[model samples]
Target: MTADHKIHKKDPHYQQAKRERYRARSAYKLLEIQKKFEIFKRAFYILDLGCAPGSWLQVSKKFAEDNLTKYKDQYYHRDHYVILGVDIKKVSKIENVQFLQNDFTKPEFHTHLESYFQTKIDLILSDASINKTGNNFSDHLRQINLCLKILELAEAHLKFKGSLVMKIFQGADFKKMFEKAKSVFRILKAFKPQSSKKTSNEIYLVGLQKK
Candidate 1:
């Protein structure tokens, strides 16, 4: 009925997500990533950063719960699913997701994560970005800096052979960031899901089988 609703209804992914009970259209992006990379395979603990609106957390919770059932008999990956979501903005609660609304760049965030998960993360997902100033270059640079910080967290918290997916903007230093990820991950690839807005420079960088 509202103009915003009409505009959102124009997007097939948005409509599909609504019908499927997902929190947002962005859910499709993670679904596509999972399809391509199998990043959820054998993952017991997942950390979702910049998880406001909680769609990725929804997807992660589903896959993590499934993994609990699927890997029940396995020697590992059978731990009760631990899915954590972090954001600077508050998110409505999702069942089974433990959320910490805080600035991840700060030290307290890492301390909370270490206390919560207890062990190294099996997969880390970050769709987080800096608040856009509507200036593309400036926003891109800030996002790149955030992506770099994510890599630092990966270094400290992710287990060997773990997987990661992060959203980044393409601009100056994009390749530099990509190569930097390459140094830490054995397999790294950039993916732009069909669900992403055509005009957006946002892309998902997937790091699999971390060394």
Candidate 2:
């Protein structure tokens, strides 16, 4: 394999964007999905699940800027944006976003989220996945289970008409998962962003108008 081949084999857009902005490649995925779905515009309070590294928080903070940085860790103040990011893994410091280190699946997660927002969130996004074991079936199952838990959490914490975006693998439970999302959200669709590699099974599900 040549050097050029190896470089090109990686996600070209992701690499380019990351180099230019110093953000994770996953940032582009959220941006692409948001651009197509328009779920971020009206969001007042946002929750980012599995939010380590702060890419999703970066995207959301740009949307939630309110000019006053009330939260101590939240540094960027634009005028109306509020962002809360949580993950099991620790993340680097980010201005204009609040970071919480904890497992989101735990009940204690609500305490942090509620304190951050003081109310229900307008948008919830989970770009989380289990460590890939390289076994396609098991990986898919693990991802699906994670998505389900995030969905349940969203249903509990999100305000009416809020939106949710979750990353899930295309597999046996994909359809059932979509159906469950459809029941709670008025609009549900799966999108594969141009930035996402064609070979990856990862697909983003955008749920709008939470019921």
Candidate 3:
């Protein structure tokens, strides 16, 4: 392994995550986003796509429960909050979280979501990406496709004025993906958290107040 890779294996965030019993070190990324954007504010109903090992779900559940008694917002239909996680792989059970073992990029899955929530989502989180192939350009394009798929799902299920946070690889098509996201959200931002490795190309796209 390279020196940077070896250092990352011993990073403080990873150590903290293990000590806290979080599902993975990725939890810190979401915590940083929440600190910067307050995306969880008054957000009760949450959808976590590609949530395997359930790190994001763990964070979402914490925020959702906190929003339960937030005096209710006038612009949204959030009389209650539910957290649902979908991935092809199964995650160990987390209290109050429902896990679906199915591909979320399918019409059937979308249909199931409509029935399951019966209302719009307050926030959507996606840390999903294509498995890397070690070819930077190829991996970037693949991740861009996955982001497009996630954008479509967000459009269908997210509530009016809902928020979305998703990870994307920075590369040739990043600007194109960011612009596409702009068309869907009134406020769009590209944020990089300190917890991420310096060498990684990953950055998160935060879309707020979906239009």
Candidate 4:
């Protein structure tokens, strides 16, 4: 095998210390966004759509633990935090988090939600992506449809002043989706995480302060 060929096969983040510690390159994406947005502060209930192998779930658990620790002295009573993660694929295993394997586009998905929390969710996250057929237009359409369905479910579960963070591609009806999201949430932002490959079109849309 050529040395140049071997170089192309290496996973850049796999050799990095942080990736080894966290077990995922996607973990850095959440860390970076949380650093600036403070998305985890005082968060009580969070819903993770398409959470498999759970990098965001890990970050969220840490946040809840910190919140409990930080307020123990002042509040005298600890608040309970509920975290639920759902994906079409089964999640390996995670502590202090509920994992469900089901298609989010179906009605049964809502049943999973009803079975879990009685109250509204504070944050909703979806890194869900459709299997691409390599046709850009078709891929974008499928992804956009998935994103819209996620938004519908998110809107139903999210509490007043809650937030949603989702992955979207810049194509087809991306602009229209953004505008639609803005109508329901006070703030809308599009962010491309550093962990994402330069050649990829994945962009995270954050809808904050739900109305």
**lDDT head-to-head 2 vs 3, winner:** 3
C-alpha local distance difference test of each model? 0.92, 0.82, 0.91, 0.81
Model 1 agreement with the true structure over 1-211: per-residue lDDT tens digits: 9998898989999999989999899999999999999999998799998999999999998888888778655476475789999988999999878998888888667798899999999999999878899999899999999998999999889999999999999998899999999999999999999889998999999999899
Task: Score every model by TM-score.
Answer: 0.95, 0.86, 0.92, 0.89
Model 4 alpha-carbon miss at residue 176, Å: 0.4
What is the C-alpha lDDT profile of model 3 across 1-211, one tens digit per residue?
9997787578999789888889988999999999999999878788899999999999998887777766555764355678899999989999989989989888788888888789888899999988999999999999999999999999988988999999999999999999999999999999999999898999999999999
Instruction: For candidate 3, give the lDDT.
Output: 0.91
C-alpha lDDT (0 to 100) for residue 200 of candidate 4: 89
Reference-based lDDT, residue 124, model 1: 96
Off by over 4 Å in 4: 1-12, 17-20, 72-78
Candidate 3's TM-score? 0.92
lDDT of 2 by residue, 34-149 (tens): 88998876676788999978778877877566323443344323355677788988998788677888998887777777778887888999888899999999999999889888
Q: If the candidates were sorted by their lDDT against the true structure, best first, what order would they fall in?
A: 1, 3, 2, 4
Please report the TM-score between candidate 4 and the true structure: 0.89
Give residue 157's error in model 4 in angstroms: 0.4
CA error at residue 133 for candidate 2, angstroms:
0.9
- Judged by whole-model lDDT over C-alpha atoms, candidate 1 comes out at 0.92
